[model samples]
Target: MVNSITGLISNIQRYSLHDGPGIRTTVFMMGCPLRCAWCSNPEALSIEKQLMIFDQKCTLCGECLIVEPEAISLDGGLRVDRALIKDIESLAHCCPYDVFEIIGNEMTVDELVDECMKDEPFYRNSGGGVTFCGGDPIVQADFLVEVTKSLKNRGIHVTLDTSGGLPWDQWDKLASAVDLILYDLKLHDEKRHIEYTQAGNSLIFENLDHLAKLGKEIIVRMILVPGVSDDPKDIELRCKRLRQSKANVSLIELLPYHTLGKGKYTRLGMPYPLGRNNEKDKVNVEEIIQIIESIGFKVYYRSP
Candidate 1:
């Protein structure tokens, strides 16, 4: 008998030019518990598997036929006719620019290692490996444990991109599993945090404190979303906390709010969270950067 390494995977982003360190494979896991208004990957939010069809990207090739007849014609353009999905999946395997995609699938740890191993040479030469990004990897504690363990044993560096809003015990279990952490700090005030991201900052701040105390190599991130999250006061609040913490703070990336996920809302039958926010002044980035840097923290315009 053999013990298998199984993990929940929503998307396999190979050759991701941007993330951290170097060229890496980004494994987006499903099921995030955060409702951040500026979330970019809403499709990766649910724990359940879903078929994401981009009408703009689709060629109307009539592919993706499910075994059940009722599963067809999700938006009148999939055109998945009599062709069996087995063949269609193989035929349109990762179509150019992702015409259609099945978000989230369960795979074993061994299977995940096998998949990531394809970039072993790149990892070795560039000092890059797997980055566990998800709705939030911390949400799937056990699977994250198994996957990171396997990757580490195989000499792969693992980075956890999180919101730092997990159970303290879970954080304790996951602390040593990965090589680095990319934690997100959205809003400052507890009330504002809940109103914007729908999560309390108490746990997030607690996790941040614990990570700092553990001497974890952490990179703090703040998404600068125009007038809302990019306000001078909000920026100063998070920056002050970072400076006061034991963690080595770096430059925060001001990811100017964009409508990247606008279409996803309609596809998911949900409304886009884009609300009233002032047009981000182009000078805001420099202003925010200067403020953070003035505190003696090496602040940058992008991800630390």
Candidate 2:
């Protein structure tokens, strides 16, 4: 008997510094348990191949339209007939300017390892390695476990950027393999959590609690949505929870909400429920850092 597993990968970002400790390759996996209104990676929201159109880049070359089993039409831009779509690769490749893009690809453990290893010199030189970010990588625990094992064997550091919404029992081994956990904390209030994230915070809290109890290295990444989760009291409560959880909260990173991925929704022909928070001046990173550090935690801003 043999065990073989392949996971759907959304993208493999190379030479990324913000993802972890040093220069690293960040593997973006598909599928997520929660749909946060402010999610930046709209392409990673679904666990399937999604067509993205950039009309500005389209020269009306008609290359994509000429392909047999024609999946695209030019109605002011490259419009894909979802019902007629067959080979995603075929349609995507037909584009010369790459206006038509495919979001996800399938990769086996060995294949992904090969890709990650290509940047071994960079990782070694910078004390950086590989990070598995998602739509929650925990969804593909088995595949991640195997890939993590391989990376660890090569002395490469591994970081799992997760929402911490899945059952701990399912990926406890994977957690043990990780050098750091980039845990996301959206909202502390349960009702508000569901209202924004389309899910409750119970499981996320439980998983974080258990991981903290295990004394795993964790860095909490909180999204600062203006008027939504920017309350000082709520932030303080969250910090207190982390302090009580006993998790080695090395850093608390406040990520200010951006409308970067909002355009992606338009490209995908989907509704962008998370509109821009125009009151950007309201976000005070220094003050938030003070509140978090008051609870004895270090703080950083994803963007100030």
Candidate 3:
């Protein structure tokens, strides 16, 4: 009976199909432990509220400059020096045209449920419910558990889309709250996992094993990143682990490599670390499907 609980949310996307079984309301929470190079939602990586400067949306009216002219400058185009600002939160109100938009929202569990209840009709018709997603929603496990408990009490199907990088104790708490788990397996080798995702896979594998033993309905998602996670040996090793776990895997999804998040770096004034290798990292969907099917698991493809 947890009544008062609040979580930092990045976005609450409605009618999302690829996240789960049906049309789902994917609640994207802020913060993540691992920093994956190919993260699609870069804004959600940090726990704090961030400001995104969409230059395309700017009219160069210099309304934001009035708030902090020293922090922001207009040369050829508008440029915001985020480093110079002490209190960046105040700048979000300075923009009238939404060129500088804050990307996080703090909402209580009751408030969030009220928002989700608006789409209950859609959920019932499409066999879709609510999905708790990232930047690794498991980072806010306690908040998620409470919110999910409330959702389930209302007879809503809840799904957790996670990277399985959290503690086993947290996973134990979530096992009863969620209806399904959409787990991500990036790399099989521990060293390689650290090299790319900036985290180890030991806890991930351990938690997966524990969840499988509990017989939770799970869907494993593996993103095919060329020269990084797309290695045949890595894929085979991951599949072997899944087979050994004996978890009820509804599907094994192979998401192809894409440059969808490349522009996000420019928006955040950060360098794109993956370079221009997205084109080369692309995988053949049909071939991957066949390979995964041969491993005695149902395979699905989402092209890059």
TM-score of each: 0.82, 0.90, 0.94
lDDT of 3 at 53: 80
Ranking by lDDT: 2, 3, 1
| 2 against 3, candidate with superior lDDT | 2
Q: List the residue pairs that clash in candidate 3.
A: none
Worst lDDT run of 10 residues, candidate 3, spans 276-285
- Candidate 1 lDDT over 1-304, as tens digits, reads 2437566787888887556778799999887778888787887787876555555776644444333344456466564433334433443464555765666688877788789989989988888888988888887877778778878889998888888887778757676788888888888888988988888888887777788788878777778776567777777888788766777444455555666677786665466776754344443777788887877667656432
lDDT tens digits, residue span 1-304, model 3: 5468899999999999989988889999999988898887888999998878888888888887778888888888887788886666778787777777788899988888888888998899999999989898888888888888888889999999999898888657876679999999999999989988999999988888888888899999999887778877778889888888888898998887778778877888777777656567456566667777888999887864
CA error at residue 155 for candidate 1, angstroms: 1.6
By TM-score, is 1 or 2 better?
Answer: 2
Residue runs of model 1 more than 4 Å from their true location after superposition: 54-101, 276-283
**Order by TM-score, highest first:** 3, 2, 1
lDDT of 2 by residue, 44-114 (tens): 87778777877789888888777734667777765677678777678778888987788888888888998
